[model samples]
Target: MIEPSDGAPPDSGMTLVEVLVAMGLFGVLASILLGLGLSTQAVTEDTRDRTGVNEEARIAMERIAREVRQSAGLDSVTLPGTPAGHTSTSFTFWTDFNNDGARTNTASDPEVMTYEWDPDTEELSMTAVTGLATVTRPVLAATVTSFVVEPRSSRWQYDQVGGACSCADGITTWRELDNSAVGNYNSEPDPQELRFADLLFVSMTVEDGNGTQTYSTQIDLRNRS
Candidate 1:
């Protein structure tokens, strides 16, 4: 058919411009995919951080609840409200935290426990003295922003005598135990009249670099009573 036309048929192949356009579209899609992947990674990291903070708070709060429910001698619940030479800002306490309400004097069973937070360092440290037993537990590794312990006593009375605590002198300032606070149970006139079946309130707050979290619990101290 008339020697092959010098110019090839019209629709044989795409022009260079068309190919370039297709390549550009593919690149755009790839860029979108990359952006989505980065976003997902960031979300996962944030969730992990929040979960870790919650677990730490939960562990510490649970430990405290268990010990409190089994608290035998509320009278001996020594909370260091002020540091030795410090003012009312310093609050610490030593009480029976074991499942058994018995106080341990020897290294085997430590009955006395102390919880304190250093305002300057923000460190929450725990010291326990059982019968021949000594154990120190840390509540937080970093600087603690806040720490508070309110006893849920059935009796509104607090021992407000200005004298040195049994553990150490040079430290005075005690309040009569009371249960007026909600989630607390110091409303009972006589502790002996109250049973272990009674309910008590517990609240706590903890903070880290990221943020702060609070824990509230109601427990029956009969087992520890």
Candidate 2:
């Protein structure tokens, strides 16, 4: 006769310890995947922030250059330099704002523009004055950390513009952003003239949560005599 049958059939399922180990391993894998996903998302956000800051800075610089170039007379300009005579956070000028070959800035129609930087608020703004009405608008708020305007006289050699100049359009290359008037188009002494300078060395730095970018341009003022 065969031996007596075992009390229970052979065990087919895992033991308690094995089940617990498997559960722990699965938990570890899930945690690792979650961590990697979060890391990737953070990197993407940072890159976007940096790109936005750079683009914003570039736009601000171009705006200033465009307006200054159209100006016919500079009332006053403040740049950063020795003796404290050339250093200031604001510049004022009267744009040529000609109405299609017509004259502008008469006794009752004079228009003045000013660009001012506030260090405490980290803001840059533009102010326009027409006769007695004055309006101030924000240009680049909370992005521009520094705005320095350096005034230079005409006629520097091409080879010396880069090395001797404190700024350039981009990457410190010496380039005339725009051609000037054919000749001394306005030879008369303009009441708005300041130091009779024609070139503006603009340097600005912008920063955000991501990073900072600095841009510089040599803007050739219009209506130079």
- Summed backbone clashes in each candidate are 39, 2
Error of 1 at 158 (Å): 9.7
Reference-based lDDT, each prediction: 0.52, 0.64
Model 1 sits at a Cα RMSD from the real structure of 9.9
Residue 50 Cα positional deviation in candidate 1, in Å, after optimal superposition: 2.3
lDDT tens per residue, model 2, 1-225: 444487666556998999999999999999999999999999888778877777777787888788788877567654343214433477887666654443343545545778888766778888877555677788864468888765554643322232455554233111221122322323222222244467778888888665677789988887643
Query: Measured by TM-score, how close is model 1 to the native structure?
Result: 0.56
Model 1: lDDT to the true structure: 0.52
Candidate 2 residue spans exceeding 4 A from truth: 1-11, 79-88, 100-111, 155-193
Backbone collision tally, model 1 = 39
| lDDT tens digits, residue span 128-225, model 1 | 76455567777765445666544443332323322244342321112322322222333232333222123444455666336777778865556433
Kindly give the stretch of ten consecutive residues in candidate 1 with the minimal lDDT sum: 168-177
Top-lDDT candidate index: 2
Measured against the true structure, the TM-scores of the candidates, in listed sequence, are 0.56, 0.67
